[model samples]
Target chain A: MALIELRGVSKIYHLGGEEIRALDNVDLDINPGEFISIIGPSGSGKSTLMHILGCLDSPSKGSIKLDGMEIGSASARELARIRNQKIGFVFQFFNLLPKLNVLQNVELPMVYAGCSSRERRERAMDALRLVEMDNRAKHRPMQLSGGQQQRAAIARALVNSPKIVFADEPTGNLDSHTGETILKLFHDLSLKGSTIALVTHDPEIAAVTPRKIEIRDGKISKNVDAKLSGQHDGPKFAVGSQQN
Target chain B: MSLLNAILVGLREIWAHKFRSLLTMLGIILGVSSLIAMSAIVKGMEHGMKEAMIALGGLDKVLTREAPVPTWQSHLSDQARGRTMRDVEALQRSAPLIRMVSPEMALERVTISRGDKRTRPSEFVGVWPVVIEMNLHNLEHGRFFNDVDEANAHAVIVIGTAIRDDLFGSPEQLGREVIPIGERVQINGQTFTIVGMFEHYESDQDRKKREWAREHPDEAAQKQAVARGRPGYGGGGSRSGWAFDRKNRTVYCPMNTMWLRFRAASGTGNVPDPTLTDIDFKVEDLSQMEDALQQAKNVLLTTHNGIEDFSFSTQEGNIESVDQAIRNARMSGGIISAISLLVGGIGIMNIMLASITERVREIGIRKAIGATFLDVFTQILVEAVVIAIIGGLAGLVAANLLVRFLASLSPTGNTPIVTFEAMAMAFGFSVAIGVLAGLFPAFKAAKLNPIQALRYE
Candidate 1:
């Protein structure tokens, strides 16, 4: 079974008495150890798809399967358990609990998941080491540089050893140099047997991921391989090369 | 939640805005203080009144006096002077249901002289042994007259403590002899010997009884020197107005002896007409006293051909009425205090509700983090109760201090005694107020929905 699967997934929100379809029967599959990026414009439903795949929100009329286990139809507690145990989220804004230091912020998932203090501390330290943020563990987010804060957020997401990492515009708030550095870390995580799903609009940010899926007008419109360094052939694209 | 965690949470929240929390606690503090102060004041008054009642010789007693208010009046003709020995007999028969009832005859205007060391108008109370015990009197010396004196019509007397000091100036005059101011030299011509003396209230009544023997030292000296023989030259005479204020004073002689000497030689055989008043009677229980007095009155009224001039009285109802009034005042004061506390409790409830609204977000977070609603509710309620309990203790101290300060400045200059009942009730009521004050806040906290609460901005 695929590690991440979306079956006829769609999201329709009733906002102010108007039906807004954020996803239109989106179907997708990606295997373990795949580094994937879903890229699109602001209203192209790419962020909505990321939210659904990350378990932060559920699709209105579809099933989400993670590791051959159905999660979309599970109870609220079960959903929260899946979020804590199977999914790790990295946001462009770096939503760190401001009161906690680098080490404490990284320990949040384990704390919520009821890990023992000693294990949580050791695992958080290991995650920070993997992100090259172990030296800055005692500094709060406000005290750290932009790249260091993002790295700390990565440690928090990875501290629970989740099955998948879902990052939405992870480098959107960083300079190109820091953004390149973060993309390299994601590549390294994927190489080390972790599945990575990232969402970004920057072609440079997307180019590092091995697989790319595009969303437009609440539907999948573009599919390509960023690792292949190939072009997109579409209604709105100029093809450098085409892939069958 | 752990108790420590809950208490810490309460303390931390309260400390976050000290001014607001302290203001909220004021309502409970005021309520407790008022209850304590009110109870203390009423308790003090009750104590003072009881002491005064006892001083009037009727704290828990009932003495039968000629009532109808006119019984003790002088203008009722000399015919209504006192009672016959038959009245005493009837009183002794009908009176029960109490501890002691000793007949008393008190006289004033009696003079005493010991080798020109004179005491004029000395007050004397003639009492049977039981009557002395009825007053809870602790004697300094001597004993009371026994039944033998009554059977023999002996001329023996018991005197007040004040009179004893005035006549002898010392208690060592216990075995000495003295005389009463009267021409009953041998009391209807029966020679009497001075036996014992006793002390009652602030002086030696026992010594004064010895002084009654001293009034006729010549009769006593001759009797002691000679053996028992009927060869003594002493005479008995009729009653003399100069010897006593018969209307106001009572001289306790045995009823048999009183009738033998003072009863008129009237035509009634079984009992010398009871109308010929000389012997007086007293009853034991205050409740039974009125009936005993009424029986005597009925007997007299029937014998006196329905002359309504005579009266009977018992201090029973008057003293008890005052006691009941004090009790009623205490109850009303307590109720008023309770109402004020309730008003204050409502104020506390309102303030707690406001606090709950203010901390809505914190409550939501705590609940979302696996804290049961009971945990949140109990934490808030415990906070309110703690504030009240602290205030109650402070109020107790304050009330006691106020009682002491006010007692010192009282116009009557009597010591104020605050009873234990009033203090205990005040403390208990303050605690109850704490529990009552928390009810609304607890319910509000418990009823909060986690979803809605988390959504509260």
Candidate 2:
């Protein structure tokens, strides 16, 4: 059975007296250790789909089952528990708490999970080390470069040991070199059997991932083949190589 | 997360916005300090008033004096006279609630001496042994005259604070047991032994005298020398109308002792040896003062053949008027200060609301990371309370210092009594205000939609 299953999920939004279908009868399934990219234009409702899939927002209709538990109708607390223990999210804005140093930001999830201080500190350090951010552990988000900030944010997402990771334009604010480094980090985690979902508006960004799901006008345009051929083009690239 | 972590976060947030936090706490600080200061001032006022009452004997005492003759009368009649010893005897017989009636007599400008240490001529009081108890003069050392001393016409006296300093050379001697009982002194060329000393009851006049003495020690010494050279120059200044003030410089001897040694031996023509001034009446119980006063007045009028010559003054009535004034003062002060506390609580509420608005995204992020609504609510509530408590504790410290400084400046040198209950009350008020003020803001923060909040700019 798939690790995550979405059945006929539909979402409608009312904005200024106009009915807009943000997600129309979307059905999808994600297997364990799958590295998938969701691609769409600006108004394609890809972010809304990611929000629903991550359980940050509930689906307006249809059932979502993760690990055999239906989540579409779950209570707020249950959704919060699923977010904390099962899924990790990295946003376009990084979303690191600015007042916190890198290490404390990474420790935030375990803090809500009620982990002991010693264990939290150890796990946070290990996560930062994995993202090559342990040296900047004491630096606040504002003190870091854009790439370093995203690295710290990724460290935070991975620190909880979630079953799946979601990146919504994780490289949107970074230089191409830094963006490739972050993508390579995601690839390494996926290769290590961690389920990954990468959301982007650029087809080239989606081309690097093993699988791609394309969205258009609030509906799924394509559920591509299991593997996109010739996408593992090494973790590093020459500077300024990729563009819109 | 545990409550401790939440508290630490709150504290850190406060510290991050130091000026804003201080401004938020200002209202609470002012409210708490004013409350404490007002209580202290009221307490000091009560202490001063109570001491004054004690000096006037007590609420159960009454003073009866001869009333002036009717102003409508055109002709002067020699038959109408002031109260006499006979009237005192009549009251003693007529009023069962009257415990004792003591007579007050004064010998103006009499020299008092002990070896070389003599007070310049001051008033000399002649009173019965019961006069000491009736007047409520606190004895600092030795003892009051007893029936044995009065009966024997013993040359024994209890000096007042002023005279104690004058004759003994130091007021500190009174408290140190330096002036032993049976120590000899002389009053009006007659020898007397010091039997007791009166504790100094402070008044505005007393404070002035002390301040004067402190500023002009040499001048005071020269004046004492000049008064010593002349016999009648330094008596309890006849201008000091208080009987206690006069007594301070005057010598107190048993009424019989004054009659036997000075009145009988001297050639000065005056009323009979046992002639009286105003008589002091002590009721058996405080509640019986009104009845006691009326009965004594009736007896005095009857004894004088219905002349209605004497007027009565009850300590109970005097104290009630004074107490009413104190209560009025306290109520006004309390109301004004309580308003300050209310303003402080409102300030807390305002600041908490602003904080919720400023941290909307933070709240969303925490919720996104699995913080329950209850968790977010408690966190904000903790932040508000911490601010209140900090402000309250600061107010307490400031109030205490202010109270001490004000007491030091006061003539009576009385400070506010900082009761444990008052501290706890002030602290508890701040905490309650924290919770109340934080409630709406915390609720608003907790109810924010995670998706909307994360998207908030």
In the range B1-457, model 2's lDDT, one tens digit per residue, is 7888889889998999999999989898988888888887877777777776766567677888767766653143345666766877887888898988888766767787777776663457788777768876678888888889889988888877677676665643343545546777777676788888777655566467666866888887777677676655233333333655555554678877877787666544754544466688788887776777777867876776666656887766667887898889778987887788888888988898988898888888888777878888999999999999999999899889878888778745555676666677877887888888889988999889988998898
Expressed as tens digits, the lDDT of each residue in B47-133 for candidate 1 is 766665564455445444453424444455555434434445544554443344455543335444444454443334444566554
Each prediction's TM-score versus the true structure? 0.52, 0.71
TM-score of chain A of 1: 0.91
Deviation (Å) of B68 in candidate 2? 26
Each candidate's fnat, listed in order, reads 0.00, 0.64
Of the candidates shown, which would achieve the greatest lDDT relative to the real structure? 2
Interface root-mean-square deviation, candidate 1: 6.4
Q: Best by DockQ, which number? A: 2
